[model samples]
Target: MPTVSDFVIRRIREWGVSRVFGFPGDGIGEFDGALGKAQRDEDGLDYVRPTHEEICALMATAHAKFTGEVGVCIATSSPGGFHMLNGLYDAKMDNQPVVAIVGQQGLNALGTSNQQASHLERTFSDVAVYVQTVLSPEQAQAVVDTAFRTARIKLGPAVIILPHDVQGMEFSPLTPENWVSRSSAVAPSTAICPPEDDIKRAASIINAGKKVTFLVGHGANGATDEVLEAAKKAGAGIITALRGKQVVPADVPFHSQQLGLLGSLPSYNQMKDCDTLVMLGTNYPYGQFLPKSGQARAIQVDLKPEQMGLRYPTELNLWGDVKTTLDALIPHLEAKTDLAWQDKVANEMVEWENEMEAQATLTFDDGVNPRRVFFELNKRLPATAIVTADAGTTADWYGHHIRLQRGMLGDLSGRLATMLAAMPYATSAKFAHSERPVICTIGDGAFQMLGMNELITVKKYMKQWQNPQLIIVVLHNNDLEQVSWEMRTEDANPVWSTSQDVESIDYAGWAELLGFTGIRVRTDDEVPAAWDRAFATQGVTLIDAYTSRNVPPLPPHITLEFAENTGEALLKHDPHTVEVIKDTAKAVVTEGVERVKGKLHIGDDDKRES
Candidate 1:
């Protein structure tokens, strides 16, 4: 008779799980033994040990993000299982396919206040799409099968709570009918498409507008060429949600970069002024940035029917595969000839590009500008580089300054906005597509959050790297700069303890000790040279850069209240730099207005009704 743990591990492999990331602990020895047996047999899943269980879960989520396959991770009972929640929530929010197998204390220990005791099924319920506890060997096979299927089909985290004693019990072998199947029952297809009449109505709305714009998201991944074709036929200017940043080529004539706070001025202009907005496969949450009621007639296309018009009021909603729906709608659209809207969007795009270049090159005489780091990295980025940015000030630079070229992949936090995900995401990207160079940008505060221990995971797998250029660029500003700025702008408070006056950590020394080539950069001129050295290194490298904490991540659309609060906070803390802050704010606003004034007819009517 086979042990329940052996059956579970074999079932996981049958479901095409090649690797499992986890941290080893007590009460899970039987499961570990099963994994060990699989490895020895040369037909089982490979076990990857990370320094922490949270990092393990994050690596699994990122694996699914990059590979479009279900990611697998495991953890021991109680505290170890609880540590996996943050990463599992990231997967849940980002809609990635991940399955976490948590070892609970012995079945006999239930409700007895035993050591490492936990009600894991209840604890994992909210974070998982499907949660189940295997109470006996009779239920192990069905429970494990359901966990894998639910993860891939629902595109979120699923959990299997395995008890220590249950996993050790002898079990009967599974028959052929109990084996895993490759095909999914819940994937997108034409059968899930909306009614023909709804698609026709959407096409009519699009055809009626003279100035239409397309807002796309990650759901349009496989429909790039079709989307471009539809945009050209409809004469629509294109803008993307952050997740869809690289889904369409940014260099296209009608493309206007991303929208919302971490976006470009041209994108804001297009979304606000268009007569019709064609939303494709994106549930962009910033309703304030989108066109208000009666401003633009909206049409939405999405695979999920419930999400079709939840973000914005829709005149017509088409629910289907983006590629298939676009194929049907294009034939019904009238070929557009008006270049007025296109020219207006194009002019703003040029100005935005020029403004970005100016901002990226602006450096203080004293400290390194973090924007310049992104500029230099963009210049050195390979066409196939996979870039990931942690949530913080570094994300601001990565989102705005970095230009993802063709064949490049940009990994963001999406809805989670969690810190310390960048390095793990990049590490998984390296393993999933080892031929591509992987770069992760993280702030010093974010680096210390959960990323410090994960460097060992990178070093552990460095021998298998195909690119030999796994670079982790640390923006060593020694402050929680983003949170500090938010405290001032959002709450009208001083920087407070967020910007602690602590001594800098020796990040470069730590990296060097972990078998990585570490380079510390304090000057702007060393930025590009440091990147050159990192790419030339044989394995993992960390470029720890000391940047200024005073430079703020300026918003594309500045409000009077924000400016006022920021100025007041500056006066309270650093009175000497008030004028500098004012100048920076004014320069960005003035440049943006001048760029789009000609197209928007800003001064054509001096009839000031107010």
Candidate 2:
């Protein structure tokens, strides 16, 4: 009879999981044996070793995000499993399909408080959609199947806890049908279209409003064309949540930028101006950005019925996939010939672009500004590049400035809101799509937190990468800029411990020591050349640029609270408080003026030309 480990590994491979990310340990010797034989025979799953189990979990999460396949990661007993929690939460929060297999202490050691023992099931309960421990060899197959199936179907993490003793136990005979299956563990799931009456009701609601805006999300991933069709018919402008940024091209005539605090003025303007908000495939949680209840009629479409109207009160809640709903609802919509609303919003976007360009050009004499650095990177980035951003001011800059082309794939921690994921996410993207350039943007503080160590993992696997252009852009501000900005701008508190005064490490030097082409830039003149050098280099490269920490991440719209907080924080903290606030306030006021002019028909192009 085959060992339980043999059956577990075999079933994982059978479930269409070609690779597993994790580290080997003494407690998982039986599983390691099975993995070793599988690798030797080239008939089992490929095991990828990362420097840390958290990195392994992050890599698995990213793999699932990119491929829509069930990503798997393995860990040893106790501490190893504990390390996976952060990454597992990243997957769970992002709603990516991932399965974590953790080795538990021997079953005989139960209640003995053995070394490396913890309640694995209890530990994973909150993060996993399915969590169970295999008590015996006979239970291995069912546990593995349920974990994979649940992960894929639920689009979240599942955990399987295997004790050391159970792993070594004799199992039932391994038949082909018992271990291997042709279908994907999650396949045979059908697309759910909304009922005809509900679709018609949604169409009716959308048609009734003269000015409408369509908010798209990640659920609209593959239905871009249909979304555009619906938008055209309904005569609506399009705005996307951060995850749905790629659903519609930013350069399109009616497509506005993202919404919320990190969003653009045009998106906010469109949302406020629209009479009806037709939300598709997204339960974007920022209700403040959305029209309040009774402020606008709403039509929400989601594959999961429970998500419908959870964020906003919907007049018509259509339960369906994005593409199917759009296809069914299109014929019912009245094509609006008077596209004045969309055209006006489009003109505002052009003005916003002009403002962005002007802001990107402003910089201090000490170092290159973060905006210009990102602007230059955006210019040089390949159209087919895969971009990942760490959670910080770096992501805020990227969100505002970087406009991804149709072929590009860009992502940040949308809901996880965590740091140290960018490097692993970019690495996974590079590994999955080796022909595309992979770029990870991170702040200096976040880079020091976890990204610096993960560079070694990139170096180790650099030879296997076909693209040869794995680039890491470090915004070296030497502080936790986002946190500090929030404390000052949101809470009106003087920045105290939020700011870091650590001696700056030569990030590029570290990259060079790790067998990567490293370049550090401080001037505007050196910016483009550094990016060019990184892109042209034959292996992994790091471009570290010292950016200004004082440059405020100005919101598209400055409310009274934001303005007051900025003034209060500056007066209380910095010596040059007035000058700092005045300088930043100039840009904010100018953008605000343009929005007013657009609303009042003062400076619009058509009005001016007339």
Candidate 3:
């Protein structure tokens, strides 16, 4: 008879899992041995071992995001399971389907306070939708099936705690005499359309408003055409949440990129001015950026009923798949001939783009402006590229500068877990789509935390990819830039240099030591060339971009509070006060100049026409 571990592996394979991310330990030795045997077969699961258990979980989350498949990760019990919490939370918060299989101390060791014998089910309760342990070999298949099914249906993580001794036991098939249950590997359909009455009510509100805005999120991924069509019919301006960036093409005339601190000015203006608001698929967390509570008549459509009206007071809530709901609602919407609102939004977006370009080109006294690095990378990004960014100024530039084309895919830790997911996400994206180029943008603080170790994992599997283009862009600023800025803007506090400053490392040298191409960029002029060279390289390349810590990532709409707090912080005599003030002034002045230039150009066009 086969071992229970072998049966569990076979069950996961039957569920269509082609790859599994994991790390080996004695707690999971049986499963590891079974995996080794499985690897010898002609059609077997590809096992990817990242540097740590945390990375395994992060990679699993990325796999789900990129491939739209159920991501599976395995780890030893106790300490290994503890390390996976952060990454599992990443999946949970982002609403990705991931299954974590963790090993435990033997059943005989229970209640003895033995090694690695903690209550895993209780530990994983908050992070996972479902958590269970296989008490017997006969129950193994049912447990595995339920975990995968629950993960898929809940759109979150599921945990399976396998005891060490249970894995080596002989597998038993389900039968009438054994009191065992059988489960299927088939996945259920998720597409749902809202009721006709709800659809009509949503349509009526959208139709009656003179100025309308659509807030699109990740739920709108596959319904791009429907969203565009509905927007055209409703004559609405489109604003995407950060997670919904790829749902609609950035170049759409009526679309104003993203909305929030890392968002565009046009998006802010559209939200503030629109009389009607329709939110789709996204539960955007920033309530301050949204229209005031009674200012606009709101309608929200989401797959989860609980998510409906959670962000704003909606006149109507439709719980349905975004694409199906939109398809059903679109026919009821009367076509609007007045597209003046869309035209105004498009024009503001043009101005916003001009301001961003001006900001990107500004020179800094200390080092290369980080915006310039991302600005240059955006120009060179291929349509087939998959990009991942860490939480920091990297996310700032990525949100404001990078305009992902229709076919391209990009994501980060949506809930913004700093220094935890970027490199692992990129590694997993490369593994999932070996034919596409992958780019990871990370700050020095985050890169040093875990990214360096993941490079070894990259090197070990570099030859397995058909397309060997994985570019890691390191913004080598010797400070925790985002935290520093947040203190200034949110707390009116000066930079606490002792805690904020990061130890400098020769990042490019380390990459070169690992036998990968490494390029160092110091000046503004070198930014474009460094990106060019990284893209041109046939294998993994790391661009160590020495960037300024002083460049402020200005919010789209700067309020009195932000201005006052920044001024107070500056008055407190921060170490980089002079540089910060200078950089901030330059960015502000550049935007003013760009706005004036745009007006003058328009005036000139009017004069010629007259």
Candidate 4:
């Protein structure tokens, strides 16, 4: 006679909970007992122990996202579970499949104001796709099963809490007797196609409009090519949400590379003028960017209905698989659209191309811009290699600089854009994709945010398998360059950077502590040899370069517009560095304004040409 904890463990496994993240504590006492018991009873139910709760959930989220499987994360009581909420939010926003388990106080103690028994459902309501609290052991299976179905089928984050007392009680089975042998849950109909009328209306509206635009989001990930097909057929321009950027390549003429925050101007302006906005698979967050008056009819297509009208006004909401929805809509559309509108939009996209080239061209003089870094990295690395980056400036740099020439390979991190996930996530991605070389890039400040202890994981994997997938390059600037720039240029106090000091940790020494091969490059002259040694390492290797902190990135277009001052900004150096600060002063005072005056513009006469 086993307890509900036994069934819970079984259910977790059946849901393909291959990995569990978070700490063990008293709140999950019965859970701990059940896990220990399962180890004795079952042959291979090994639980993974992560150093931090946040790392654990992040690991689980990455594993699930990369493998297209249910990522399971577990935490005990309120505190540990709360630590996982950020990663849970990332999973939800990224549309990754995630199932969370939190330990609760016993049922009787729940209402007694027990120490660890808290209102977790209310806490997670807004962040998760689905959430439930089970009162009985009998209900645990159903609750877990439903959560699993929601996570796998909806491909969204879901949560379930098991009270300690329920874990110790046995009940009738909710799943089939041979649960482990069941097939995996497929994406539910709700995630793909919602209703019939909305679908027809969405199609009809697109059929009527002369100029159609497709706005993609995370929800529309799997159907990128199909959406492209519909765009090409309708002679429509494609615009992507921040989440959808990686789904569609920036190089495509029809694709709108204009995303929010640090995104470009073309897609944003194009959005303002379109006659029809065809939402393909995305639940874009910034409704403000969408037309305010419904002048541009919005034809929404997604797997989830709840997501529709969440951000903007929707004239036609079609619920179906993005791939299927496009197929359904294309038949109703004319075989070809009037190229007059499409070509006008295409010509506007030429601005994006000129901007891209301006952004990509790097001078030997400019020390390091994220865009330039990505440009250089692209040439050195193979096309199909994997990349993992922390949030913050690294995310911004990558978002602006890196072009997603491949498939659904994208990002992670909560909306706050917090940093320091690359190393840990790279460990998971490297293990998952052993055949692919995994690149983890982190800013100096970001590398210091997480436990330096986890570098051991990379060492362990390399020692055991002689794996070459892990390649971590720390963007070693002395301070948080992005924040420092924001403070100086944008007039905001620089957010506190996590960097230890101007001359921080002996990064090479830290790498050696964990059995990783480490190299430090003191000058730009050492770049080639340092990179060579890194590739020759037997285990996880770290390349720590001393970079110029004041070298602000000057994109071609931006630099061209502010030519004189651009050169001045590029020359500005951190006081401690050996860069040419005097040269910047001369350029700024002499003719910076005149250089800016020479630039070109059209449409508006407010000032310098755009």
Candidate 5:
């Protein structure tokens, strides 16, 4: 008879799970054994072991994000489960469907202070939509089914705990009885649309306004055509949340790139100036960047009703799938002839792009400008490339400089947890789409935290990819750049060198040791060629670009509070204060010059060629 562990593996495969990310331990030894047996039996499931449980979990989340499949991760009891929390939270907060199969102490050992035992259900309660422990072999299938179902429906992580002994038990199917519930692997359709009345009401609100702005998030992904059509008809400018970057390409005329701190100036201005706000598939968290309450009438469309009005005071809420809802609502919208607002927003976007180039090319004495690295990569990025970024100044440069063309995909930890999911995300993305090239941008602090370990995971699996063009770009700034800026701007305090400074590491040297091509970049001129060599290399490559720590990751719109707080911190005579001030002044001056040139049409003939 097949063991319960065997049945669990077979069932997930039947549910279309071809890959599982995990780290093995004695607690899951039986399952690991079963995995080996399945592999011998030519089972299609590919089990991948990362260096740590946290990385495995992050890989699972990335798999779901990249492939649009339910990502599954497995880990042992206690410490293994604890390590999976951060990645699980990343999935939960970002609303990705992930199922975590964790080991637990045997039923007999429960509450007995057994070694490696933990109350996993209680621990996972906050991050998972469903948490269940299978007590018997007959219960395993149903639990697995329910876990996957809940994860898919809720769009979050789900947990299934299997006691050590349960894995060894003889598999038994649930009987047709009232107490023993049986479930199928088939997922229900999610094509939903709002009622006709609600659609008309939303249309009326949008039709009433002179200046309309559409704020889109990750949920609007597949509805790009509908969104663009609706925006064109309504003469509205589109602004994306970072997660929604791929939904509408930045090259689109009326699409303002991104919103909030990592967003663009045109997006910030559009939100503040619009008379009407239409939110689609995104619950963008930064309310301050949005129109003030009562300043603009809002209409929100979300698959989840609960997420609709939480961020903004909306006059109308449409509970439906983004594509379907927009498809239904588009016909009801009246076409706008006067596109002055749209034209204005588009022109601002052109100016913003010019300013971005100026910022990227700004000279820094300490190291190469980080923005220049991303700006160069942006020019070289293939349309099919999948990009991942870690949380830090790396994300800032990525957000401002990297423009996703059609067919390209990109994402990070949307909640910005700073656990450094970029490496794992890129790893899983390459696994999901073996034929596509992948790129990851990370800061030194995050790279030191967990990215280095994940590189080994990449080294182990590089040959498995059809296209082994994985580029890991490390922003080798010898400082915890983002946090230092936050301390200065948010806390009005000087840099705490002891806590913020990061020890330098030869990331490229480390990659070379792992049998991967490594390029060390220290100057602006070397940045473009480094990208070129990485892209040209047929195997995995790492670009260790030394960037200036003093170069500020300026926001789209600098407010009074931010300016004042930064001024206060500088007044305290922080270490590197002179460098910070000089870098900042240069950036601001560049922006001003770019703006003047844009307005006067002075530099159009002399624009830098790509």
Candidate 6:
């Protein structure tokens, strides 16, 4: 005899899930009860409590992104369920193996309606691989199997909606047959590599180019090593999307700077100069930064065939999982270029870095030294340390800085930049490894946008992390960092942040109050010391480094929806930005439609947008 809760928990363990990142509530009683008993059991796993459910999902997204395993997160009904949506959208957008478990009020309580009652399943259906509600123990087991399958086959995040009453209910001895998921039911292949000729043709282009450049994206995470080697053979330069930056080592000579809005100015400048531009593992959409097909040969290799040439036109298209294609291409390619090319790209990369830090407005000349903090921490951190960044200007900065050491960043992913995604994503990243130190780089303004509270998961799930510590170094540029700068550059009044009462709500104090080892870092020296204490002393730590919020507005900066002054009379904001964003978005959307017409990435995803 077993219970739905037992089956779900057991299923979680079977999938190698040792840590679960989430926030629970009164609505999830029976499920939580099972969680308690399981934890008490000899084999029970860890429930990772995050500062917020949204953070939990994003954390789960990162954990999944890096490991290719199903990253799991949980949250309660109503707003909590809604809270997880933002990060799930990120996971789905980036195709990470993420699974979100949501607690429900009661199946019977539907519309007959209890407090906090809301449409949880309907809310998440489109964003998830599959959205389901459990009714019986049989359905519970089925959902568990579905959860595993959804994560693996769908290639994105999935939501398993659980009814509280069914969680711990007594059930008859269920045979193992129903528990083992059928592979066909979970994962269905949606795309394929181009024909044999396509691969050879692309490989030929790679072997021919004297100066080849790679614009790597999130899709290219695990294949960095292979891509680097290929670059070595071609004497090429490799650049990555901000999210994909960590995959390549900072010290790699061929590792180039990133491209797009908020990327290195030099790389953006190099777009027109390269002889051949290669797009790998990334579906970077900014056309302004992409290489021009007429000027440079553009080649694309991606996991999905349709991904090639969606934004930038491609001269040669090769479709295969990055690792697989690299294996095949290495044998096909001949040594074409010399080490001098990688050296030149590497030099340009260094110059770009110096210029970035020098001109950056985000530096703490007043008192805080963000550049120093990031540089020093990056130096001391094991090339292996995983960094989760919240979307804001800091993401752009972190994008510009913080390259991982060799092989350490093989698992990290996600570039659909959004804020507060870092807190929980790091919470999940650290939790996934438990002992692995996961650091979150975020801005104070961005943190206020979401899950600034899931820190409790630190104390609640202490036993899971051998150290159970999360080190969050907040780059607090007191002004509405991006907006204020936008105003200054354009000569308009900055809409300074009303995000939080910063004086009243000191984040370091909140971390301290939450049983964390909070350290306020007002100067540069304290940044490393705080990190040392955080790593050595244990528990969670918050290093509040008050930085200047003068960083450049990350490009693709919002299409100003409202009246915003841009120097001359407060005329309607720049229409060009909106038009570019719309055009970029449409190119992607149009590509999808064309693919659906030709049977591309859509599978059994039944959620209808129309």
List runs of model 5 lying over 4 Å from the truth.
600-610
Number of the top candidate by lDDT?
3
The weakest ten consecutive residues by lDDT in model 5 span 601-610
Give the per-residue lDDT digits (tens) of candidate 4, residues 1-610: 7687777777677665655655687777788777877888773245665666777677778887667677877788888889888778777766778888888887778667879778988988998878987777656766777888888667678888877777778766456554232333333544355456665676677778877777877566667677777777777877776556667765686565645544555565566668888777776666656775767887777666687767767786776778766666666666564777666656656655445444444332434434445555554555556677676566656655555665425554634455666766776676566666667878878777673656765554553333564667777766776666554344423224443244578887798777677787665556657656655554577877666564443322232324444334434533322343443332233223332343322324223533
- List the candidate 2 regions with Cα displacement exceeding 4 Å: 173-186, 497-499, 574-586, 589-610
lDDT for every model?
0.81, 0.81, 0.90, 0.65, 0.89, 0.67
Candidate 6 stretches greater than 4 Å from native: 105-118, 135-141, 165-195, 304-306, 315-317, 338-341, 356-369, 410-415, 449-452, 459-464, 467-470, 487-493, 496-505, 510-540, 551-610
Candidate 4 versus truth, CA RMSD in Å, comes to 5.7
Per-residue lDDT tens digits of candidate 3, residues 314-399?
99998888999999999999999999999999998888898899899999999999999989999998989998999988889999
* Poorly placed runs, candidate 1 (over 4 Å): 173-191, 498-503, 574-610
Writing each residue's lDDT as its tens digit, candidate 6 over 323-438 gives 77777777777886366666766766665555444433233345565665676666567545777766656665566557677655523234466766776667666655666777
All candidates: CA RMSD (Å): 3.4, 3.9, 3.7, 5.7, 3.7, 10.5
Q: Whole-model lDDT for model 3 versus the true structure?
A: 0.90
Candidate 6, number of clashes: 13
- Model 3 alpha-carbon drift over 4 Å, by segment: 177-179, 599-610
TM-score of each: 0.92, 0.93, 0.97, 0.80, 0.97, 0.79
RMSD of candidate 2 to the truth, in angstroms, is: 3.9
lDDT score of residue 513 within candidate 4: 78
lDDT tens digits, residue span 74-192, model 1: 99998988999999998987778899999888888999999999778889989998999888887787788788877866768999988888988998744445443333223232335
Q: Could you tell me which 10 consecutive residues in candidate 1 have the lowest summed lDDT?
A: 601-610
